[model samples]
Structures are given as C-alpha cells and as structure tokens.
Target chain A: MITSGDHMNWKDNLIKIAPYVAGEQPDKRDFIKLNANENPYPPAPGVIKAIEDFRGADLKKYPDANARPLMKAIAEDLGVDADNVFVGNGSDDVLALSFRAFFNSDKPIVFPDITYSFYPVWCEMLGIPYRTLPVGEDFNINAGDYNCENGGVVIANPNAPTGIGRDLSFMREILDANPGSVVISDEAYVDFGGVSALPLLREYDNLIVIRTFSKSRSMAGMRIGFAVGGDTLISALRAAKDSYNSYPLDSVAIAAGCASVADRAYFESTLKKVMATRDRLTAELRAMGFEVPDSSTNFLFAHHKSRKAADIYDFLKSRDIYVRHFRKPERISDHLRITIGTDEETDRLTAALHEYLG
Target chain B: MITSGDHMNWKDNLIKIAPYVAGEQPDKRDFIKLNANENPYPPAPGVIKAIEDFRGADLKKYPDANARPLMKAIAEDLGVDADNVFVGNGSDDVLALSFRAFFNSDKPIVFPDITYSFYPVWCEMLGIPYRTLPVGEDFNINAGDYNCENGGVVIANPNAPTGIGRDLSFMREILDANPGSVVISDEAYVDFGGVSALPLLREYDNLIVIRTFSKSRSMAGMRIGFAVGGDTLISALRAAKDSYNSYPLDSVAIAAGCASVADRAYFESTLKKVMATRDRLTAELRAMGFEVPDSSTNFLFAHHKSRKAADIYDFLKSRDIYVRHFRKPERISDHLRITIGTDEETDRLTAALHEYLG
Candidate 1:
C-alpha cells in the first residue's frame, strides 16, 4: 500500500503551474519603490475618515455577500446602473473570474505578445488555450491583429511595459470584428490619461471594462477592483465570483472604496500630479539618451542607447531606487518600466540614474 | 454573424452554475442575525487598537504577497512551523484553492450528505466529481464509510447544522484508509469544543486542517482563514494562491488577524462564553420539547416534537429573530440551526420560541 514513501504521488493530480511573480515589495522603508505601478499619493481624506469612524465591534458579523454598497458606489461614479457593476478583491481577482466566466470555448483566446504578464499565467492556470499576437514595431497594438475567430480577447489599454494607450476607435474596431467573442478591456492604468473602453459599452454588449483602485484611488492596501459591462455580462461574472467565494470584498474595503470614489476632487488632483511627474521624467530620460515612448499611463517604458537595461536596473537597486525589468519573450528585454512616484522620489531616481550613466 | 441577437452565445462557453446563496444579510440593524453562525462578541481589544492605529497613508502600497506576518502569528498560535501554514481571503478561499490543488483524480471525492452546502457548490463549479454518504442516525460522521477508494476526503468535524464532532481516533481511521489521497479536515467550528485533526498532522503528511477567524475570533468581516499541514501540502496551496491572487489578505486583515491571534486571553474568554451560552440554550430548548443535539460547536441543532420548523422559522423571523433552517436532504428538514448569541440574545430567542411553540 502507498504510504509516506509514495505520499508525493498525491500531488500527481495537481497540474503543474508556473505562478506569476509580482514586482518586488522591498523591505527597506527608505527605498524609492518605483517598480509596481501603485499610486504615489495617499488615499482620499474621506477614506481616512471612514477608517477612523469604522467600528471594530461590527466586524463580528459577515459582510454583505453582494458587496452592494461598493458596487453602487462604483456604478454611480461611472455613470452606470448598479446592475452593470461587479466588484472583487482586486482587478487580478476580477480578471481571473472573468476568464473563468467568459472564455469557455475550445478556440484559442488572443492578446498582445507584450502585455500584462499575468494574462498568460491565468491561461496556463485555467488550461485555456491562447495565442499571442505580436505588437507593432512602434510598441503599439494593431487593431487588425485581433479581427479573427477566437474564444476571447483581452487588451490592456496603455499596454504594460510599453505604456502606449489605444484610442476608442481602435477598441471599436476590435469590438466590431469580434461579434461573438467577449472582449475584456483591462483599464487598470486608464485613469492616467488613457482612453477608457467604458464609452463603448453601450454599443458593444461583449465588452467588459475592468478598473482598479490600487492605481488611481490610492487603495492598493484595501484591495478594491470593479468591472463595468452590460447587465448580462456582469451577472455572469457575479455568478462566477459567488461560486468561488461569496464574500471576497470585506466590510472595510467596501467602506474604503465607497469613500475613495466619492471624493472626486482628491482623485483628480492626484491623477494630475502623477501625470505631471511622468511627463517630466519622460523628458529627463530622453535627454539622458534613453529612447522613451509616449506613455499614457503612470509609468514610462524605455531603453538607454548605449547601456544595458539590466545593468541600469541593478545600479538603481544599489542606490535604493527600484524599477521593473522584464526579461521574457526577448522583444522588450532591453526595456525598463519605471513607475512615476512623488516629485521627491522622482528627483532621487533622476540623480541616481545620472550617477550610474556618468 | 453573431451579434446582440446572439450575443449570449458568448455565455455558452460558461458552464451554467447555481451559485451558492449565502444566508440573508438583512439591511435592518435590529435583527438578531443568528442565521450566519457569526460570533456575538466583539474581537480582541488589541484588534481595535490595531485598526485605530492603522496608517491610511500606507494603503497606497501593496500588501505582502506571502502575508508573512499574519502567517507567522497563526503558526505560533497553532504551535506549528510557518512553512506549514497557508492563508487566504477566508476559509472558503483556502478550501477552494485546496480543492483545485489536491482533488485532481478521476475518482469522486467523498463527504457527508448533510454537510456544508458550499462543498457541493465548489465541486460543481470546479467540475470535480463527488459522492455523498449518509451520516449515521445520530448525526455522527462514520469513519468506516470514508475508508474507500476515492480522489479525496473532506470532513467538517463538529459538522454544520447537525453540530456533531468526531474524535481524533475517528480522524486517524479515515487518514489511515486514504494513504493515497488528500484529506481536508474542515474545523471551521472547532474552537468551541470539538476535537481537532491538527495533532494528526505530524503523522499524516496528506492531512490539512482548515480554520476560520469568522467564528470564535469574531473577525468575520475581516475575511481571514488558514490551513496548517505538512510543508509540501502548504507549498502547493501557496502556489495555487499566488497563481490566483498574490495578495488575497489585505493590510487591515493582516493586522487584525495578527492582533487577534496574539490576544490569547481574549480569545479563550470568548470561547468559554459561547460554550456556556450554547450549553444553557441546549437545556432550555430541550425543556421546550425540542430534541437538541449534543453540540461541540457554538450552535445548537434542534427539532421540535410537535411544531413544524418552517412555520416556527417564519414566526420567529416576523419577531426579528433569525436562525438557519435547511429545506433539502429531507433528513434535516425539521431541524433548525441556532447560533449561540450573547446571553441577552439567547434569552430573546428562547422567549420567541416559547411564545410560538406554546
């Protein structure tokens, strides 16, 4: 009989998967963390008030399973009805549920070759067959590449590691072509000046637009994300979420998310600051001989003319200035993705780069 | 050729699932809210301080992907190594990931017929085939019934609704029989008085013990749950979680969980109070002609001798008293699962029952 000697065989049933590695969360308190695209500003004042006013005693009960309060807040903020919104722990959770709910066909789903790293990881984890269409030579997604028979299509607007945003016209073209496929517009960084697919939701019933508070609303620690689409599509995602975990959004998150969305003034103010810093840093990197793309999001993707990107990344780390570098697919291996931080952090990073390049 | 007229064809790929319906979360503030089996007492005093002292500014940063601090706290509380712990949004999340990680064989997994309804919902959602065995007439899980060729085994000790707990000797019998499969001992209610399968972890490498903060710890709103097992089993669960959502436990939850686990005195006090209330209520219920089961959990499972449970349920709800009643699996149709609330809430529930039954 099989015992401890063969206990390892029990793992044979679990399919082997290579998990997605998130950007490093460094331990040092003084490091300039410009790796993950988290918002540089603090959350809204209302959010802080909500946390302060929150009663610890009330946590004894289960939170609302539907997350109705947060969903209503998101829907109202987006100028949509409550039925059209679906909320989750984070956008990754939202995207994962969407994949399980919509991409169920035998045909291969399609996305850009250089997109969010987690996209392929989800496909591999869920056993969904996928094909990666290469981005254009200019680091832009060509709408024509997605006009084919497929199970689903996911486009990260202002596509990651490239920071190039697509227009509503480009999104409309893809939605028009894929009449039978569900198209997910992951607008994680859309608030940073990218064109959102939300406007096309009325014209395209197959479109699902996902947004995250981690970037714009400055609540990464609270883990709030929502998806907006037609009611039918939203119901499918809701069903998928309910089936997985009934109460993914805790009470504090619901309250914090509501407070963050209600404070539009603070939100817009932070967005302006992030974009200003991103634009200023773009010019600085260019003057330093780096070929930087025009970024619509909060980060810049670039490679130096004469220096190795990995070497620059290492040098930045040595100076406690961190940035992201992807070494996969070999196409964008030479590029470094730097998240826009506060003005002070940006200045520190600039000084570090000057010292390294000299 | 498919358009809005056939737009729902996209949903065809999605398997039609009957989502699990959690207990009613009534909007009114006055309801007793005993239907969900939540703790009546507030969380540890340290937990409140942790929340009040929390820095809202730090919310812009992502939480630790590994949840190392919370994991270490739980490990110390359980007297296990940190590597043997796996944490998630809740026990439901932990169990869902475990099902995905371990229950992969073609053989149908086994559980009791009158077990947690979410178990079957998970199997249906994941496409994992399962078989249900009937518990004995006394509502006790029969260990010999699980001694069969199966893909996996799941036993909710101090079983839900029935409130019957099996001994560790019984757990050993099942574990010894299933040397080739993973055994998940869901002790969601074990803190009250139930025997734990945690001791058997040293002997059975395939055994996993799942616990929740939603019950005795009084942090249901925080959404924290964990599993303790051999390092190999825990590693597989971690890989599955990292593949799904790298940060399921947000900042507030981690802080609250760590505080709650550290306050051993407060945790034990609440447990004793709940058990005392449960025991007193059991006697009062028996005197009122209800055959109350000997419960090891914080709830009582009882059925009236002459009163129909459905009518009694409605009558009590009309008076703003809440309790759980299962309609399916005819065996438990006549019974009601009443959570042990505070002494005052207990008095109110007993009075309501007396008013109706008499």
Candidate 2:
C-alpha cells in the first residue's frame, strides 16, 4: 500500500497550479480575522429560521440541478424572468462555467491586470488562452487595449486588491469596443457602491452579471452565487453547470438563499451599515497618514508608501488581528487589503495602527 | 447595448452540449416521488435539530473551502486519515472531477453500456471520448472486457436502471487488469445491499470509492458526497474543486451533514428497514410475473419484453405513480426504473402494476 495523494498522469499545467490559498482558520480564541473579505453581519433572521424549520424529506433526494426556485426568487428580486438567470456554488463557480461556456479557444481572453486574481486562474484552469491588459495610472480599465482580437472579457467591479471600480459609462464603452467578446461584469462588490450591469442583460447575451451571497446577503458560508444575462449566455452556463455538478447547492442552501434575498429590508439595512463603517474606516486610516483608496466594497486597500507592508502585516499579526497582504504584482507590494470590521473592531484596528506607527 | 449570449465564442463542442435531464420536482403536495432513487427515511432527528439551533455568525463568513471539518468527521468514521479523503456538493460532482483528473485525455473511459445514464453524458460533455463495454446476458459487468486501451474506469455499484451489482473478486480483477487507469467505484447503493470498495483503497491509489448521503444517511436534501482514496488522488480532486467552487456546502448543510453522520444508531435502523422492504418488494415483483433484477440499491428495474417501457411509464404517470424510462439503448427499452417507496406506497405501485398487467 504505497499511500499517495496524486494518482496517475496529469497535465503539465496542472502541475504548476498555485491554487488560491484561503485564509488560515486557527482554533484560537484571541484571533480577530480580517483576512477574507467576508461580511461581518450574519444572514437575516428569516434565513436562520428557514434553515431550522426546513423539513423537506425530498432533500434526501438530489436538489433541482436547475435550481429553479432560487432562480425564480433571484429573478423576482432583480425584476427579471427565470430565463435570464443562472446560479452556482458561488460567484467563482459561475465565473469558471462562464469562462468555459463562452471564451474562444483561439483568441485569448482579456481582463485588467489588477482585477480579481481568480480571472487568470480560471483561464488557465479551463485551458482558455488569455492576456492581462494593464490598468491606467488612475487604476481605470483601458477599453482601447481590448479593441483587438479577443476571446472573453472579465471586469471585477470595485476590483479586488485596489478597491477601484469601473462604472457603467466605462462598462458600456468596453461592451461597445469588444462587440464580438463575452463581457462578464463581476459585481461581487457592486451592492457596496457600484451600479449593476443586470439591466444591460436585455440588450446583450454576451453580458454576464455575476453576484454573490457573501457580501450584502451576509451568507458566505451558505455558498450561493448567481448570474443574470440574455438567454443564450444563460443557456451556455446552464449547460456547463449541468455537465459538471448538477446539484451545486443542496436543499438547505437554496432555502436559505431564497429567504435571505426575500428579506429586502434586512439586505438594505446591512448594506447601509457596511457602507457607513467603510466611510468611517477610510477616513480614520487616512488620518493616521496612510494612503487609502475610496472603497466601494466592504474593504479598503491602503498603504503608507513610506511604511513597508510586511512590517505592518507583522505588527498586526502579533496583535492577533489578521489582514491580507500578497507578494504579487510588484506595483501593489506596499499595500494591505483590510476588510472593514464593525465600528468597534475598526476602532480597535485604528488604535493598534496608531501604536504601530509611533 | 448590443447584448448577445451567442456572440461570445464557445468551444465548438460546448454548443452541441445537451445536459442530462433529471426527474421533475413538481410544486404541489409532495407526491410519493419514486422518480429519482432516494431514501424514504428522513435524516436523524438530531440533524434537523442542529440545523434549527444554528445561531452562529458562520454564515456571514466563508466556509473552510477544503471542508476540513467535514473531512475529519468522515475520516474518523471510516478510520481513514483526513488526508485520504475528499468531499463535494454531491457524488455527481466528485464523479465529474474524477473524470478529468484521474482519466487520461487520450483513451476511452470504460463502463457498462447499460449502467448509470450519467456516465456517457459526462464523457460527451467533457469531450472525453468513451467506448461502452456491453454488459453480459445476466446484465453483469464482465471484468475481462476492460483489458482494452483504457483512460479510466467507473462503475455504479448496484448499477442504476438495472440494480444488479458486481462481486468483490470481479472488481479486484478489473482493477488488477488496468493498473495505470484510475478506478472509480460509486458505492451509492452499497448500504442498501452491495459491499463497499473502501477497504480496497489501501491496495490501490487508483481506487476512489464515491458515497452519498442521499441513500443510507437520508441527507440527500443536504447534498453531501465523499470519496475515499490514497492521499495523492485526494490532492488532485482538492485542486480541481478549489479551482472551481471554493465552498460546495453551506453552514446549515455542513451542520446537518455532520449531525447526520454522528447519529449512527438512526442510520443503522433506517438501513435495516429499507433492506427489509427491498427484500419484500423484490419477492412480490417476482411473484407478479415481472422480470425484476436482483437489486442492491434502493430502486428496482423491471421489464416485460412485450410491453414498451414508454407505454408503461405513461400508464403509471396517468395513475400518479411515476418511474424513470430512458430510450437511448434499445436493449432496456422495455424496462422501468422504479424507486422503492415506503410500505404503503409500494403497495399502491404493486396494485397499479397488477391492473396494468391485467
């Protein structure tokens, strides 16, 4: 019995895969984790109740692979029909399926170099050739760069790491520039501040707007994500998902996701609270002589430029307050991505930074 | 807004994709659904209670993408190390990932021509060309036929559509013959009657045993599936899953699954009852002059050469007693895949069949 974790032959590229390293979840009591950009608020009370009372034995069977009920709920909330919706395990799953379903094998896909890190990962994993266009000095996407040969397009609204968003005017410009490409608007943070691309789905089958339950709905552990688009695009994603994992979500997930979405009042209130915290935290960080981006998401990307990011990271880690700092893209080396905690946690974070700076 | 779903180029193969259609989930008073093979038993009472009592903010955070906690629970139950295990949304997801990770890109993957309908569907969707190995006159898988050029091997124990299962000696022979290929043993029906291939994992790194909560555990609505193997094979699956959906199960689902697994007494009793019913129903079907397969799963496959499977399916549906009928391979055209219902529901099916035969 020669024990092994890797079996048989594998593709050469699979060997080089540096899979995304999720935040470490230590079992210590003193830790305050701001590593993953997860929502601070719990799911709406209705969602909790639904899970507790969900007595459907049919769940002992496979879930509706089509996720018809969740889609209906999402569509109704977004004021669209079921035909325009597709759902998955998370926004990441939807993005991966979309990449496989729509990206051309011949032409390379295009995305901003500083956008979501997962974009390149998807292209590589799917064997879709792709290129990363550099963001402008203002950290804005250059639509002209993707005017040439293309496969698919991905724009992370309120892009990760930088917290810079691409608004609708620029989004429409890119959609126009790449007439032949599938444009995916990843609105993982849109509800935080940016406008949605869902309304544009009526005009473009190529436009895919991806959203997640992790942020506004405060159900990251529930693992639900959705996409809104024209029928053709939705069909392709549907085909890929069905071919892959028929029941991506179990019965409890769908029940809770539907309940969370239906509680519009809770979602609205949660969103407002997060936005208020984000505004306060951004000002506080700047007051301590740090350069922080005006964030649209629940997190801020900040740097002192004078202070080494690693030193600050070490200082925070010693205090059991964990934030994210990646050693990638040399240009962003000085920055730290901090998820905005509640008012009390933020106050604690600012006080710690004040001591560290002194 | 020049929106189009079709304009974004897809792989030439993606357009030709026709996903497998699961049975209907009608939004009425839940009928005694005998379409998909699911356990009639509800999950452990503790499982329901745990889900109901979940008042944690875990839902607001991301799940452990690696599913470390669930893996530990499964490993502890199986007496295997956590490293030698993997889990996903359902067994179907694990099967799909295995096809790409363990199977070769060059040769045809082998399975029974009359086995689980999803086998060929997966092959077609992944563009992994496959050659169907026809089952014997007894509907038994011939281990000798697998000596040909092989990419990998997959077998649904107590094979779907026809519930007959293969013996351990024959499985050993198949695995020995194809030393280089990955052998996936889907033991979805094992607890019902068939023996598990889990013990074989120590002998072959290529052996992956897929199990589901849908059957014996009665948590199918919770959508949790697991695979047991040597560590290396597990790593490949983890890589594929991480690159796809980080969190396959939500917090409530995680809670439910764990609690269900913990209550061993409940599952043991449920299995005994289901097995007893299976034995009784098989004898009754045989006495009724219907040629029934010796089932090891929760379903029975029966046929009358004179009657078309479609006609029988329609006849049952008209009476609100539904069964699955596939028309692809001509051999099983006269057969119906019927799920084993509770005692009363089985009696109804038997009464309905008696009338149909009369």
Best by lDDT: 1
Each prediction's total of clashing residue pairs, residues at least 3 apart in sequence or on different chains, is 0, 18
Output the number of the TM-score-best candidate: 1
The stretch of ten residues in a row with the least summed lDDT in candidate 2 chain B is B6-15
Which stretches in model 2 have alpha-carbon errors above 4 Å? A1-20, A56-58, B1-15, B26-30
The candidate scoring highest on DockQ is 1
Q: What lDDT score is found at residue B291 in candidate 2?
A: 82
Tens-place lDDT digits, model 1, residues A1-358? 4455755657777647654456676777889889888889999999988887789998998888878999898888889999899999999999999998888899999999999988887887777899999999988899998877789999999799899998999999999888888999999999999999998999988899998999988889988888999977888898898888988988888888899989999999999999999999999999999999999999999999999999999999999888998887799999999999999999999999999889
**Candidate 2 per-residue lDDT over residues A1-358, each given as its tens digit:** 2123323443321223554567667678877778888888888988988887887555677777777899999999899998788988888888888887887457788888888887877776667898889998756677777666677788888788787776677778877776677888999998988778777776665688999988878888888889998877788888788777778878878888889988999899988998999999888889888888788888999888478988999899888888888778877777899997778878778888999998
What is the two-chain DockQ of model 1?
0.67
Residue-wise C-alpha lDDT for candidate 1, range B1-358, written one tens digit per residue: 4455755567677647754566666668788878889999999999988888788888998998878899999999889999899889999999999998888889999999988888988898788999999998888888999877788999999899888888989999999888888999999999999999999999989899999999989989999999999987887888788778878989988988999999999999999999999999999999999998899998999899999888888998998988888888899999998999999999999999888876
Worst 10 residues of 1 chain B by lDDT: B1-10
Residue B145: error of model 2 in Å? 0.7
